[model samples]
Target: MSTIEDAAVWLAAADPDPIHARRWIGSARIILLPLGERWSAVKVSEHQGLAAAAALRGPSIHDPSGQCVYFLVAPHTVWDAPGSECLGESYWLTVPTPAVKEPPGPYWLRAPDGSGQLVDAEELRAQLGARSVSAAGAASVKQP
Candidate 1:
């Protein structure tokens, strides 16, 4: 098999139910961390999200309905940020399968390229904080 396909298969090993109808589903193999007890997510708008993903140069997921992007981090990762969502153990994030890279549904903005690469929690927190500060500054500026 090709490298990407092999990587996809390797990544999919995290699937709790590989046989399930939906190729995409919740995975427990890697912990999503950032400002939480265990799993946390930093949601960013479409444009900013894309930029952040590019800046990080790591795996990220895009949710069309939510109009945001998510960067999956390592199990041991952690960060403290205001808007971050702390997901409990029961919370199962629906992720796209190896083949589902693009979206009509939740899809990978930056799929794992078989390097076992994930977003760094510290880097993500910094990006979010910087964006938040910039947004606040813009909002507080007086209209001419």
Candidate 2:
């Protein structure tokens, strides 16, 4: 099965409250919260279009100590599958808010038609030009 299919199966089985599942279908950044090993809360960025780019270039969210964050980037169409149920047709970047203790496994970056790529946290961060923060208050960018 394709990665998207696997993600769909996981979403259906893992996410109990589908209604609250956070998603964005446009040019925006989203902060996600994990539901067990799955994503639960998706907080979309207020910035859109060019504004979204500016936000990404800006400072990282002030997270508490020892938190790890992950990001996933994809086009909006990937959620159009029968069960995906997403709305919109723009580029999207998804991240985990409040961060996770360890790195999140690979996530799906789907297109509007349900085709996409499976990328891990480090790759996503590199693509976004984001810097990884250490517990000791140091930050460094990981080149792809």
Candidate 3:
């Protein structure tokens, strides 16, 4: 199977309606992590979120509202970034099939790439902190 197909299968394993039909695309699933808790996510503002994802070079999902982004992180990560919220157990994420790459709805900014890659929580925290400081400094500057 191709990489994306593999990713599709991997992700679809979480579908609660598995017995109804094996959907490969054109639908989304409300899922916990597959493979005994494989990942978690951090939700942040699109501004800093995209920048952090670019810096970290990891997969992220851009929310339909375009105001926020969800950065996928390794399972059991302790994420306490000031401006971001960690999504874990008891939290369900709506994930579109691997084939959906753009919106009207949530889609990948950086797609999974079939590598099972996830962002490092510490690096994401640092990047967000630096950006927040920069933004705060810019906002506080008085007009000359």
Candidate 4:
């Protein structure tokens, strides 16, 4: 429902740690799976094993090229004390990436509020989606 820019602002206001700034600024390859008549996006990590686990659990197709949409995430963190920090709220800024290829089915983006948006393949294509890069390359591609 909100634009990626909006998500960025929200992330910035939430977590302002400079160390995580680099990883949090770019787009993430989200794997989307077909659900009944719509598609739902799956959140994955940089770890291939973890991604595979997520794919298996979601029963979603895992594309070797992990490309999907760009999202700015303000990692969930908690402050144990004044100078100590732990993990807190999880928030992400989701935006469509036109330079990548659209998945076979519709894709969804979940807002920080927990609501989801369903986008059709055609609409994704019209945006000129980008190609996603797989973390493990050809060797990591799996069929499930």
lDDT of each: 0.62, 0.28, 0.72, 0.30
Which is superior by TM-score, 1 or 2?
Answer: 1
Clashing residue pairs in candidate 3 (N, C-alpha, C atoms within 3 angstroms): none
Q: Which is the leading candidate under TM-score?
A: 3
In order, how many clashes per candidate? 0, 4, 0, 13
Q: Show model 4 residue runs off by greater than 4 Å.
A: 27-109, 113-144
Better of 2 and 4 by lDDT: 4
lDDT of 4 by residue, 46-87 (tens): 243223332221112223344423222222311122211222
Give the winner by lDDT. 3
What 10-residue stretch in candidate 4 is worst by lDDT?
A: 77-86
Count: clashes, candidate 2: 4
Against the correct fold, how does model 4 do in TM-score? Answer: 0.21
For 1-69, candidate 1 gives per-residue lDDT tens digits of 665565556465554543442243234222222222323345667766776687786678888888888
* Steric clash count of candidate 1: 0
lDDT for 133 in candidate 2 is: 29
- Give the C-alpha lDDT of model 3: 0.72
C-alpha lDDT of residue 33 in model 4: 15
